[model samples]
Target: MPNALSESRACLPPPHPPEVAKGVILDARHALVHAEQGWMAIADVHFGYEARRRRAGALLPDWGMPQCERVLHELVRDHQPKRLILVGDIMDGSGTVEETLELLKRLTESVKIICVLGNHDRAGLKRGMSMIPSHREGEFLFEHGHLPLSDHEGVIVTGHEHPATHFRDGAGLRLKLPTMVQEQISAKTQRWILPAFSPWAAGGEYTSEHKRLQTWACGKGRVWRV
Candidate 1:
């Protein structure tokens, strides 16, 4: 693997944070942040999803890791957060976790990385990285959203659904883009599901009939309210 930086890696640029809550910022690259504490939250990266699919007879291109690396590098460069909390599902298979470990070895030098294990990430936890079951930041409970949520769960922040929407770009080209779904469950509680950061994420357009669901759709370097 080549670790050389591209002189002009113009394709993947860092995104600006679109304020979702009082202190919560969602960047176009699919990162959620609590700015006051310098903590960045991300979920549903599925690092080896493509490779897993390919092995399962899906004709997918092997482009997941490099793309993830580019987005991550750009994200770190732009935000420079003190800590990065991956909510869950960082990889789909063991081979992919090994790849992720190699990437983390370099990333850990600059940013402290933490991975909250997701259903597809058992192998990653066994690798001895900074893996945790759940992380609490301020009043937020950061975890993989597959488990049941209770009233006592506090303000939940997660990613697993890979929510998205279909929309036209500035060039008028229709595209399936990732989305951030926020639902206010109660007077004092809220759950936010972030879009997948992997460029190859097999996301479907999300449509909701619920009255309380608020969505922010993102593409390229911009976010559009939906």
Candidate 2:
């Protein structure tokens, strides 16, 4: 007879990057997956952000597509999720529709990619997440966190705050990591702010106190509650 570990974890791929908690799978490297639903999500990709910044006279290195491809490919391979949900901020305000669309063409093959537009996604692209502000599936709502949630919703997941923090290592070195923020509004409602999937969106942090928030930080190839 199969033991409990084998039976339950047979569906679970591995013990790396993505860690599960409170019904959300933080896909090990900058993504989220709801295992039961087979839906994987990423947010704040801000594709072409560096190039856009360069146009405005900022001298940043060109390091967007490689990082994006690396993480997206890894998440897709590890989880093999059904839907690839891009919560928001798919592009910086500076990027072009052509630029964003062109870059998005290289993501996980055969996965349904859903994008929810953020404030920065106002470049007037006419398809997919470019025209939408939010996506609701059953009891769950996905949106960019630039606006307040309507009072009628129950469970909400958003990205736009670019939530992150600096973590200290045993060697006294501090490195910043993306974080998932869970906030409880009441006995019946909950909110989750997924961190930025793009490495370019680092340095954002929520310093104010939220009594009910439980954050899971991604660092050193793991997700741990902070």
Q: Measure candidate 1: CA RMSD.
A: 8.7
- TM-score, model 1 to reference: 0.82
lDDT of 1 by residue, 68-142 (tens): 877887788888989999888887766576777777787787799988888878654556586777888878888
Model 1: residues >4 Å from true position, as ranges? 1-16, 54-59, 150-154, 168-174, 205-213
Q: Judge candidate 2 at residue 153 and give its lDDT.
A: 52
RMSD of each: 8.7, 6.2
Q: 193 in model 2: Cα distance from truth in Å?
A: 0.9
> What TM-score fits each model?
0.82, 0.82
State the number of backbone clashes in model 2. 2
Top candidate (lDDT): 1
Write model 2 residue lDDT over 1-226, tens digit each, in one string. 9999889877544456545455667755767777777788788888778888898899999888567867787777788888788888887775566677766676635567777878878655555334577777666788887897756457788887878877677898988888888887666777888888888877577754445568888875767777
Candidate 1: which pairs clash?
none
